[model samples]
Structure formats: C-alpha cells, structure tokens
Target: MHGYTTDKDDYLKRLRRIEGQVRGIARMVDEDVYCIDVLTQIAAVTKALQAVSIGLVEDHLGHCVVDAARRDPDEGQAKVKEAADAIARLVRS
Candidate 1:
C-alpha cells in the first residue's frame, strides 16, 4: 500500500531497539556513569532517531506525495509543500 508497507515491521523493530537504548541511557544515569559515556549514548540515540525520521520522510515522498500528485496536480503540489515544511521542522529540531 505504501513505500514503507513492506518494511513496517523493520521500522518497528528499529524503534524498539532505540527504546531499549533510551532505557539503557537512563540506567547509565542512575549508576552515575561517566559524563562522556552518557553523552556517547545520547549521541547514538539522536542518530538513531534521525535515521527513523529520514526513513519516514523518504516513504512520504515516494508513496503519499506521489500518490497525491497523481490524483491532482494541485494536491500533489500541496503535498510537496507539506513535505518541505516537515523537513524544515525536522531540520530546526
């Protein structure tokens, strides 16, 4: 049904792994782990989240935006704008 349809499970698995990583970071804090070590884990989690965001953005452009464009040029343009706005927000974050 969509670009990510086949890989939905994979996304979920990755997200779950990231969740575990977050929990681990919490544990590290609880144990008073070294600041650098905690920062390393934090960086890893940030990158993992960025990866997921990029994947979703790709799926949006490849599937939802394309489908909308096919249905109507104006609608497609709107989708493109929306996607751009989303990317901008993500970049700002």
Candidate 2:
C-alpha cells in the first residue's frame, strides 16, 4: 500500500475506466449486441482487471512484504505466502 500511495490516483483512474467498461458490457447485453463482440469486450475487461491485479501484487510485494521482512522472519514468510496465494487466485481467475 505504501509503495502504491504515490500511484494511487493513477490506479483509481484505471479502475474507473474498467468500471465504465463493465457498464458498457451491460449496455451491450441489453441492446442484444453480437455475441462475439460482447466476448471480445469481456476479454478486454479481463485483461484490464488482470493488469490491475498485477499492479496491486507488485505494490504488496514491494511495500508490505518488505516491511514484514524487516520486522520479523515469521511475518515475512506469512506475507510472502499471502502474496503467492494472491497471484494464484489471479491466475485461476
């Protein structure tokens, strides 16, 4: 979080764009847009989300994990595992 503090505004802007994309998807569904076109937008949204997830993961590793490692070995190990699990979940999604 600390590492991301400086880039928080940028992140928020990106997320807002993604939110708009989701709304666009909903509108497309309501309008009965072509199936393939809808799927293409979905893929775009997915990639956008993954990009955000990767950024957050990087922030966590750089800030939280580093802090935890500095504070204590056990905490550091826990933080690393948590980060790994986060990546796993993102990959699965």
Candidate 3:
C-alpha cells in the first residue's frame, strides 16, 4: 500500500475544499467582485494546494522511498531521483 493510504481520505477532503474555493473564485469573477478580493482567494487556494503537495512529498519520502531502499538500493535511488524531480517542478511553479 502507498504511504498515504491511511491519510487518503483526508487528502481527498482537502482537495474537495480547494475545488470549492476555486469555484467560488470563478463565481466572484462572474459577479464582478473586487479584483483584490478575487486575488486573495486565489492566493488562499494556491497555499492550500502547496500544503497538500508538501504532505504528499513527505509521505512519499517516508514510505515509498524508505521501502524501496530496503527492498533494493537501486530502486531506492530511482525513487529519490523521481521525487527530487517532482520537488523541482513544485519549486519552479
């Protein structure tokens, strides 16, 4: 099982909340809400998503990478590389 299996439900719930926030932002745009207000909501959603990403990264490192390393050094290295690439992408974004 994945490292995050235990916390999957929590992640899904957080994602759903972020999704709702996005819809709300869209609605604000449609309603001609103040630009700063819309921007603030967007910022909030961005931070929420970043928090989720960080959690997933932690889970991946703690579970997947550790397990792979125990099972095979080569596999562990690959997982590390993969995770590093993912983190790089997150950083660039």
Candidate 4:
C-alpha cells in the first residue's frame, strides 16, 4: 500500500476543497471581480495545494522510505532519490 493510504480520504477532501476554490476563482473572473481579490483567492489555493504536498511528502518519507530502508538499503536509496526529485519539482513549481 502507498504511504498516504491512511490519510487518503483526508487528502481527497482537501483536494476537493481546493478544486472548489479554483472554480470560485474562475467564477470571479467571469464576473469581472476585482483583480486583487481574484489574485488573493489564487494565492490561497496555491498555498492549500502546497500544504497538501508537504503532508504527502512527510507521509512518504515516514512510511515508504522508512519501510524500504528496513527491507533493503538499495531500495531505500532509490526511494530517497525519487523523493528528492519530487521535492525538487515541488520547489520549482
């Protein structure tokens, strides 16, 4: 099972909330709402996504990476590298 399996439902709920926020932003644009207000909502959505990403990363490291290390060092190293790459992408985003 994936590392975040236990928290999968929570993640889904958070993602759904973020999705709604995005739709709201689109609605604001369609309504020609104030630009700054729209931008503020966009920022909020971005932060919310980042928060989810961080939680997933923590779960991965705590569960997946640790389990791999217990099973095999090489597998653990691979997982670590994969996780590092993922984090790099997140940071770049």
Q: Which candidate gets the maximum lDDT versus the true structure? A: 4
TM-score of each: 0.94, 0.93, 0.97, 0.97
Residue 26 C-alpha lDDT in model 4 = 95
Q: Candidate 4, 74: how far from true, in Å?
A: 0.7
lDDT of 1 by residue, 4-69 (tens): 887899999999999999999999999999999999999999999999999999998999999999
Residue 76 in model 4: lDDT: 95
Worst 10 residues of 2 by lDDT: 1-10
lDDT of 4 by residue, 4-75 (tens): 999999999999999999999999999999999999999999999999999999999999999999999999
lDDT of 2 by residue, 47-69 (tens): 99999889988988889999999
- Given candidate 2, what's the lDDT at residue 73? 96
After the best TM-score superposition of candidate 1, give how far the Cα of residue 48 lies from its true spot, in angstroms. Answer: 0.5
Worst 10 residues of 1 by lDDT: 1-10
- Put down candidate 3 lDDT per residue, 1-93, tens digits, no spaces: 898898999999999999999999999999999999999999999999999999999999999999999999999999999999999999998
List residue ranges in candidate 2 displaced over 4 A.
Answer: none
- Candidates in order have lDDT scores of 0.95, 0.93, 0.97, 0.97
After superposition, which runs of candidate 1 have C-alpha atoms over 4 Å from their true positions? 1-3
- Stretches of candidate 4 off by over 4 Å are none
Model 1 residue 89 lDDT score:
91
